[model samples]
Target: MKILFVNNGLAGGGVEKLLNDMLPLINESGNYCELLILFDDDAKYLESLRNNGVKVQIVPKKIYNKGHFQRILYIMNYIKNNDFDIVHANEFPLIYYCSIIKTILGKKMPKLVMTEHNTDNRRRHIKLSRPLEKLIYRNYDKVTSISDKVQEVLLDWLRPNDRDKYVVVYNGIAAENFRNSKPYERSDLVPEISEKDKLLCVIGSLTEQKNYFLC
Candidate 1:
């Protein structure tokens, strides 16, 4: 299968990391996988992806600078020319853009899939954006969420009649790394630690959506 994964950029984020880990595996399985990043800036995983034999393409600088519409046109042309079997979008505006392209292409467009990583986003808070959101999601052939909670919340928010289109695909991890790792001494890491003290670790980007303060 020929698949094109679209995202904003290859920044140091969970989505980027997921793509970094997932794309190579897809390629190794004999499926042709390519990445299309909207911006060329802050591409932390570009070299790593290329080293893994995943074809990574960025929007042309001239077209990127031209404005939103121009970039959309570029993406449309790129997808149309690539002849992909599937186009999986991984982030916000890119999801919206790909939906627009699918709507325009109709049956000519490839199978459109989007992964919803979060349970909430700014778009959900806007009262007027609901209708457009519904339309955008309707354009997708399938919508995947990172967890059951995310899928539940998304379905509740959109309330689409075709509930079967949504599915839960849990995020992956390199379990062997954890299984083969050594345990750290509590006293060595924290000299002030008590023998009976319990430690809690929270890992994620310190973004507003993470709600670190709540933790």
Candidate 2:
């Protein structure tokens, strides 16, 4: 299978590191792994892929900060020229582009997969951008929420039929990669978390309505 990975940059963020960690296992499965990073930030992971003999491509410039419609053309052009069996986006912003604009490149666009990494309710952008999301997300073949809470939040807003399109795919850690690569644990580097007496936990942002704070 030819899989194309879309990310905003090659920064050492959670999503970026996760993809790099999983690349070896996935490539060993005989899938062609191609990376299409919108940002040209450092390309820190580029050498890792090349060293492993995996095929990677970086665009000349990032179109991420550009307006949505403009990014549509840039992404669509890229997808049109690339023959990929699947296109998966790790972030929600890219998810919008993949599901909406990527479909216009061909009658049968690549199977679209989006992984929701954050709490759905925490997303302030979505409430205001519901119309845009409804149009684009309809084009996605699959939508994965990383946790049950995210799935529930999505269900409340999504149509009943659209519920079937979303699945709860738990986020994970690459055990083998952790054993081999000396990557820094996020919480360890952050000063707030205690290394000896506690476990690191993720918390979503508080939501504010027209007059009240919810959750």
Candidate 3:
């Protein structure tokens, strides 16, 4: 199957890392997978993805600089020309654009899939956006979330009757890298602690959604 993964940009974020890890595996499984990103700013994983043989396409700078509407047109045109089997959108605005494209193209559009990465977003906080979000989500063939909590929150917010459309696909990591690496001695990194000292580690982006303050 020919798949096109769309996102806003390739910044150093969890979503970007997820795509960098996932696209290569998808292509290796006898399927054609390509990425369509809106911008090229601070694309930390761009080289890594290309090295792994995942085709990464970026919107032309001219079109991207014009405005949001122009970028949406470019995306629509690109999708129309690519003849992809599945267009999986990973983030906002692009998700909205892809949803709108599916709506406009109707049956002609490819199987539209979106991955909801966060349990909460600004759209959910806006009362007027709820109906619009429901309409946008309804156009998707499948809606996947990175965690059960994300899926639960999304379903509760959208209140869509077709509950089966939402699914939880947990984020994955390349565990072998951690397993194969040498373990670090606690004293080597932080000499202040002894063997008896209790320690806690938190790994995630320092975003409000992560709720680091709760720790």
Candidate 4:
């Protein structure tokens, strides 16, 4: 199977990390795998993916700020040239883009898939975006939520018939990768930690969903 994973960029985030873990397995399954990163941010994970035999492609600079139609055209052209069988979008905007391809191009496009990694977002509450969101989501072959909570949140907003498209695909890590990993030394991140200072680490983005203010 030819599969393409689409994302805005491979920035440091949970979704990226999850994809990082999934790529190797995808390749090992004897399938052709590729990544379509919309914008370049000099992501740290780029090298690791290349090392693992995943082909990564970035959209050209000219298409970045033109408009939605132009960006969709760029994506659609890429999809056509690559002949991907499945296009799995990591974020919601890309889902809408894939939806457009499926809507206009019909069977000419690949099967559209989207994975929802977050429980909340601005689009759900915006009245004007709801109609478009509904239309796009209806075209997706599958919509996976990272957890049951996330599925519930999506169900609260998605239409009843669209509920059939929803599925809970909990995120997973590659446990074997940590099997032979060396223990971390103090100077790795914080040089201030002498050999004795106990360090408390918190991992999350500084977004409202993380609720870092309470921490």
Best by lDDT: 1
For this target, which candidate reaches the highest TM-score against the unseen true structure? 3
- Per-residue lDDT tens digits for candidate 4, residues 1-215, read 99999998887878888877788788998988889888868687888888998988988878877878888999988988887899999886787888888878888888888998888898988978777777878888999998998889888776548577899988887888889999777798787778778787778776788677785
Residue ranges of candidate 3 with Cα displaced over 4 Å: none
Q: Which stretches of candidate 2 lie over 4 Å from their true place?
A: 62-70, 120-126, 177-215
- The collision pairs in model 3 are none
Please, what is the TM-score per model? 0.91, 0.73, 0.94, 0.86
Q: Tens-digit lDDT track for model 2 on 95-118?
A: 877877655655668888887765
Q: Residue 84, candidate 4: how far off, in angstroms?
A: 1.7
Error of 2 at 196 (Å): 11
Candidate 1 ranges with C-alpha deviation above 4 Å = 187-198, 207-215
Write candidate 1's Cα lDDT for 1-215 as tens digits. Answer: 99999999998999999999989999989889999998868899999999999999999899889988898899999999988999999888999999999888889999999999998999999989999999999999999999998998999899998889899999998676699888888987889999889887778866787777786
Lowest summed lDDT window (length 10), candidate 3: 198-207
Task: Give a tens-digit lDDT track for model 3, residues 60-178.
Answer: 99999998889888988898998899999988888899988887788889999999998888888899999999999999999999898999899999999999989999999878768
Please give the lDDT score at residue 51 for candidate 4. Answer: 92
